[model samples]
Target chain A: MSATRRIRFTLNGQAAAAEIGTHETLVEVLRDRFALFGARESCSQGLCGCCTVLVDGHAVSGCLFLAAAADGVKIQTIEGLASGERLDPVQEAFLECGAFQCGFCTPGFILMTRQLLDENPAPSEDEIRHYLSGNLCRCGAYPEIIEAVKLASHKVKSRTPGGAAP
Target chain B: MTPFDLVEPPSLGEALKLLEPDDSAVRPLAGGTALMLLMKSGFFRPKRLVSLRAAGERLARIRIEPNGELRIGAMVRLAALEWAPEVRRDFPVIGHTLRTLANVRVRNVATLGGHLAHADPHSDLPPVLIALGACLVLAGPRGERAVPVEGFATGHYETVCKGDELIVEATIPPLGRRRAAYAKCTTRSADDWPALGIAVAWDDDGAIRSPRIVLGAATERPTRLKAAEALIAGRTLDGALLTRAGEAAAEEADVVADARGSVSYKKQLVKVYVARALRAAGAGPAAP
Candidate 1:
């Protein structure tokens, strides 16, 4: 097999390109190649959300996503969530709520909630629960995780200029 | 995962040209959610992984035709369909199914055509699409052809699609005045693959129409409960009729035992879910 594929995509808002093999997944390239270690790789099947990342503003399982297929797409990892000295609202809420114990699943949950709140700023309790159902917290931190999302929603809503877009 | 050459043909025509009708080694990558999983498990090792991203916008649109039909491009993401105003307005069941089918992460990347092509009997979309009278459009080096959703899947992880052919889009007919409902019973979480699923569509008067019932995830294929359909074809749905139809559905499906449940258990679940789906579709008041 020839590793002749070169993919050009936007990573954390910057143009990036990498030589990839057809078998290489997004998680491998992100953690192994670029050293973006935030997106955890566990249960490589799409089942576990540990490897979740934002591809063009939508959350996707990095382990199940082919880096070669992501050519020309925008990718956001947990490493990109914080800006210099400030944490993203989702990250702040997660920490504030103590949403992680072991924290292996924290990055995936944070990213999922970020996208969730972005899409629906004022999601109801059921909506929040339903949206985060895929991102499992093995530490049994679901109650706090749910709380974090609720708090993050309020934080996001207040920060929006007119609170029009979620 | 075994390594393979990544081929990106800029246009649909170029992609088709690269695909040969008899070459099973050339696999087209859609959202890569399902395909990637199989590759990770070492189940699928392709000689060439054809990335359709180069096809770009040509295969990524969702169009509501003037004739009241909904035309969805193959590459349209599941999340896009879940939020599409036209899809939500016309076929709300699809939106309902999408919400619980998989997690937000999977939906955001999983494509419509890839979902169908994966052809998993336990999928949430197949039965609903079959009940909605949808058709899948396939384009190949030879030519283009359309297959009704009901006849698309030939078996588990299989379809009528030729190796050279790629699913272009799927067209669902207008819902018109018919009300539809989908009921999926999972062994574990609500998001898990259904142990048994029932999708029922009927007219305003509760009379069964051209398009009818389909039981999914409980059988090898999207099994149309024709015996149950015949039981209520011309009758206005009532509690008794739905109960009777449910029984017919259980008898019609060729259920097999699995981790989800035993064969007999699934049959029983099918009966109950079918009745529940019928009632949800406004099959009159429930029997006392």
Candidate 2:
């Protein structure tokens, strides 16, 4: 039998720890160990972005990333998009734009969208498509997802000081 | 997934000490993008995994030496390399290839050393790195040694990297006035792996001085078209010369039929893309 390792990392905004096997992926640990089921485990390969999460403020596939490797890293999952009752601007925009159909890939899109908005508050249409191309939507909700990103970008900028829609 | 012991060594020296040349069961883990998949699929069943993230800050940094050479650490993520200003300005081909290497998510964590060591035939970096004349640095119990990227990969999913040796960094000399262009032909969207990839570079005179023509993804490893390069050397870049050079590249490439494409189909792609890449490099840098 293989020995288990204790991993310490920041999940959402809280410090978290888990005793997991060396081979366990972040998606498995997140969904099974900690019961944070926001990130889906569709395609375990890195090709699919269903397991996308923010690692150190950048989006990455959780399924392809080992849980033990995430020690001391700050990770943001789909469950963290809302604070208490208030939803993040991206989350709010996702709903307003009706960005999901089957909803299996919504969490990944939301997390990736959050990352995009955080990095570039104002991204062009080409930039948006280029960035989000990794995350696949099986329900063909990409059109709405793109719209959500645009809407969220506007909402996010409007709330910032000295920022307004041009 | 199979069970394995995880050892997080605090330094490169310590990690080296933990490795043994005869211990094939001990594997070094970096980024975990490709390795994890293999482990999960039961294709690789290593008994122990040495985590390199514990090598700390030094191994993760991309350094520009005083001599203007670029040293990319083994742990520097692909996304970081893609947007790095030095890479964009000095080695734009590296950045250009990185943009289309994989999707945004994979780039966020996949590292250069891991990618090179992984040595997947369809990967984008090996061909470009070989074209740039980059050297890979490997550290082990015997200390560090350098190997040219061209000779790094021995076969599919294989490299000169021994079980005890770990790829620590890749150093690239200054490009100077040389301009490079890379073209990839994928079966589907841009996100898919290349069915055929072509990387071409030329000197300031634009006369194919020390020309490098590489065709990737069609063979077991990145194949250099030395004959094609020789044919174009000292010759002006023109449609006729380029088409002849492309035909030579197609002939030299040992293409194999796979799910991505057929052997003849890939050879045809190599012929067209080699010429297209040479023209593109001669024209100017395409917008990233």
Candidate lDDT scores, in order, read 0.85, 0.86
TM-scores for all candidates: the values are: 0.95, 0.95
lDDT of 2 by residue, A74-163 (tens): 999988878899999998999999999989999888888888888799999898998887788888998899999999999999989898
Q: Report the error of model 2 at residue B27, Å.
A: 0.8
Off by over 4 Å in 1: A163-166, B283-288
Per-model DockQ: 0.73, 0.72
Runs of candidate 2 with Cα error greater than 4 angstroms are B285-288
Best by DockQ: 1
Q: What RMSD value applies to candidate 1?
A: 3.0
- Indicate which candidate wins on lDDT: 2
| Tens-digit per-residue lDDT, A56-121, candidate 1 | 899999998888878889999998999988999999999999999999999999998989888888
Task: Indicate the residue-level lDDT of B83 in model 2.
Answer: 91
Q: How much does each candidate deviate at the interface, measured as C-alpha RMSD after superposition?
A: 1.5, 1.8
